[model samples]
Target: MMTTQGGLQPTSNEANMCTNDNGSQLGTRIVDEIMAGKNVFFDLPDKLTGEIWTLKFHCIGAQPGKEIVTVNIDKAYVAFYNVVYIKSKLGYSGRDFLFYKKRCGIDRSRLLALDYIHQEEAMLSDNMDERKISFVLTKDPPSDLEVSITPIKRPRQRTNVDEETIEVSIDAYKEWLAILQHDNPETDLMDDFREDTIKTYKEWLRHQGDLPDILLYERMKNKPEDVDIVEWHYMVLYFGSEKFQKISSRNSENRQKQRTKHIMGYRTFSQISFQQRDPETGIEPTDLSLWMITHCKNDEWSEEASRGIYENAAEKIAEKIYQTEKFYLTREEENAIFQTTFKETTGCKANRLHGHGYLSRYPTRSQVMESKFLEQARATVATNQKNIELESQVQLLNEKLACEVAERERILQEKMQALQEEEEKKDKCLEKK
Candidate 1:
């Protein structure tokens, strides 16, 4: 049987070895096996056990069929056993070399000896010697030493872009309002305009600071409408004009009460509900509702949003009163109140729906001036009422004087006629005697 130099048992199927004098026979048999392809060729010198040598066996049959192979050893332990072998037998009987290595202290690390074969062989031929090999072989040996090797890699790094999207909920919306109020207190918080208004507020809170305190403050605060207009200018930049239109359309009574109470603490804006006929069919109770003026387009002041189209109807009636010299507000007061600018063609258009309430509903420039003129005319008539009364008294006195004069003249004439008649009668009596 063939034997290794370390003095272990002979490998099974190997012929028994002779003494040192018969070493030639061992060399001849090993050479013949290499030439015949029955044994794999090893680079180690023949009889490699003389100086504590090791032989690396590589499976080198080009395409040989599977067979039971036994490794023999005499002077040294089998440092490793390749697991590829179906079964391994010892010098006399079939036994696995792996089991043999485990019983011996050679594989205590549970490391298969194949782990060192390639590296050890490379060292003997190259720069690695007894010193370097000891250092390398004793440490956790690299995987490359195995008969088969695998590529190793590091894990990829994670990033923010890889995160999943999050959705906004109603509860989350309410909580956000609370946060905005806590942080900003100078603004009027009106939940009257829900969508665009809330969106604008959120954008503002986000840009308030670097590594913005939006989440932190939103978590702590309870009011959003309390945020000031100027402070939220940055946030407002992100909102488009379309969002405003949507908010104007969608903010209804039900939503307004809930959203506004949380945001502004009070309802500061108007809410009007209304409905109209479908126009496809005629029906008496077609629709009914109040008009919401806020939703009216600034340019299109039509029935669509302008509930009060005749806003200056009262002003027109007041103008009629002015033309008749009626004095509601006097000339001096009117002049002092409204100073018309004569320089511009369109100084103050009376048609301008400028002021909020009903009093000075001047819808056009000429109408406003007319109002002032009427006030002046009324005041003049009021101041000259005493002259009118004095003229009436003088006319009455002149009529009574003319009537007395006529009665005196009639009485004088009658007296004169009677005297003449008496004189004539006396003359006639004298003549007859």
Candidate 2:
């Protein structure tokens, strides 16, 4: 037995399998073994307990065995374990491994069987370190293991050219929108696109003080790389319009009325839904449960307050579930129950439902009228202020012009007087002579 670092002891047979050859030779040997229909196994050291863990790779295909071996190994390591750990375990440096992989012609893809095996092993090992693999692979993967391979969809590569400098025509913007709509017909491309552009516009708007319409429109320099120049220009103009300004302002006030601020950063509701599963049976949680899990974070809402709100919501959800003889509530029912429960408990309605329901309450007739009146009043005041400034500028210009005209008249008068005096002197001199 040869004892490696991290207290990992490989048996004589396992020790003889991995030679002190360079990466190129080792890669050649690995390919030759796969071609001979033999499984390759690597002894790796567990980071936590320093135990020897065996990783086995078997090529299933009879013909083109090299492709199968290279592809599967590449996928397994790239998905579950770091490529560097595998390189080091094989006694090869990073640069050497890169050249080795290139020489082997490995193509990376999803490995569902490997992923399933990794998940099972990780659960048994209780290792949360995703950067390192701590579990052992079986000599043969389970017969019942899921082997469905899904191709990873890569996003369209964007040009490195600066977005602001890229001049996009209206036709190009339309063509891009058409392509996007054609590709994703199910998606509300325009609405989603508008929302993102509006968000960018809001960020720019926040920094700008009171500016004239022309200046506000002219100062839209921060264009998102995804947004075409023409589209961004049109969006900026629309967002800066008086109508949209009123809408944005109203939305801002509504947002301010929200009580619960979710602490989930960069995590989608779907991702959070996975965490809300029942530990025993793996049954997915209802929408209500998901909302509570996402919102009841101690950092954003106090533990006491969160607990109180959660308990109240849970009680209400439980009663509903009991009455309906159902384990889960539909999204609509869940939203209504949550809204009612939150209002009952807190004595106030939630402004934004975090995309769970309608964002704001339907304004009453009186409220709508009042909002309209306020908007109009603001617009009138702004118009009056703008007109006053323009009038002041015109008056100043007129005054300067009047001063110039008066100075010219005075100079002309002075010149005439001098000429008259000179002529009179000439006449006197002629008469004396």
Candidate 3:
């Protein structure tokens, strides 16, 4: 039977004698603590000629335990049965390594051991060790170590070419509204404003930030996380050109009752952590941080999880007007919003949402597999049906063949009988003569 921890064990007395002979300072306890904790790095050899030793202690059969109290200096790793292992097991103190080390009588702390569980905090104090490592401890050790490694780069297949997708969740969407409110407390897309007539949209739009945030924010507010930012922007701008603003008298009171409930929309720059840009092609894969705009999903304007996609083109339109002419609301606002890049040709070649490519549905592996299985099943049924049809045709042909053969034999028998009758008549006539 192979042993654990590189497979060689030494008795506690033998281990102590060997350590004495080698003049090694740090004992088994210190090394075990380091191994178990979240230290960034540690070295085996100090001024003390210290080498780590590990073994399975007090195990029943093949099971390993936390009871390795004795360590051998000569053997780097210990075998299970080879060395009569120690009966005494050490349990962790709820405290970290530094605290535990302080409680210990040994002043060989630089050469000492501590609890491995306190690694994240311990690494701060144990900075002298040259070799650095990231300590990852779990409630249960994972079956595969590769589970922790994330690919530094994603494959090219998931590119977001049209520049529409911005990663924002529903919370992020609400935050954008909060931001718009932050920029101008009076300007709101869904929020019941104090008389935000189209007449006042120009005034509202001018106070806002530039094109990128406005367009990106509008699409993000919709439940669908993936959106074509450009298309949404153009759609928003198009609607802004039209004048009548939505006015709900009851909604105003309800809005007041809601009471600017979630006003914290502006996220700090540091909070924008989860984004990636491909080094080779400079293409950004779509980040669906926003809730997805589902095909046939029900979403509320004020609900937390998946909110409704209100037509906020009016919001986009006013912003476009602000970008073009800061304070003026004009009929030209309609014509001007489309003129930006997407509409180079004369007559609005693209329909509503010209620049966007909202996927009808997001494809998943399971969905694709289901479709393929269904297709194969249908093909199998068709083949079985065709075989049954051919079998029936063959049976009919066999019956027709048998009937033809029987009819031919019957005709031959009749002809033979007639011949016999003729011969008999001739014989009778001759006898008369």
Global lDDT scores for all candidate models: 0.36, 0.51, 0.38
Per-residue CA lDDT of model 3 for 255-333, tens digit only, reads 6654112221454211321233234333222222112222113443334322212223334555765777466554234
Ordered list by lDDT, greatest first: 2, 3, 1
lDDT of 2 by residue, 1-433 (tens): 3334532243555435544443344455644443343323332323324332323333232223221222223222232333223333343322321111001012232223323224444332432322222222233434533233223346799876765565646355446556666897874445257786555344333434424554555656778888755678788888778899999999899788755556577776666666766553444565457666666664445345455667787788788888885577764576677667777776774464432433335457898687567656766877798899999999999999999999999999999999999999999999999
Candidate 3: residue 74 Cα off by (Å): 28
Question: For model 2, what is the alpha-carbon lDDT of residue 396?
Answer: 100
Select the stronger candidate by TM-score from 2 and 3.
Answer: 2
Model 3's C-alpha root-mean-square deviation from the true structure amounts to: 23.3
lDDT of 1 by residue, 1-433 (tens): 2334422234533523312213334434444444343322133233435333323222222123211222333222222222111112112212222211111122221224433344434434331121111111222234433232222234677668868868756455456666767788664653558776776566545544422345434433443576643344434432324576477557654364321111112322221111232232211110011112322344444342132322332343356457765556543333222222111212444543221222334337787687556656665665466577777777777777777787878788778888888889999999998
Runs with alpha carbons beyond 4 Å of true place in candidate 1: 1-379, 383-387
Separate clash counts for every candidate: 36, 0, 22
In model 3, state the lDDT of residue 206. Answer: 47
Q: State which candidate has the highest TM-score.
A: 2
Top-lDDT structure, candidate number:
2
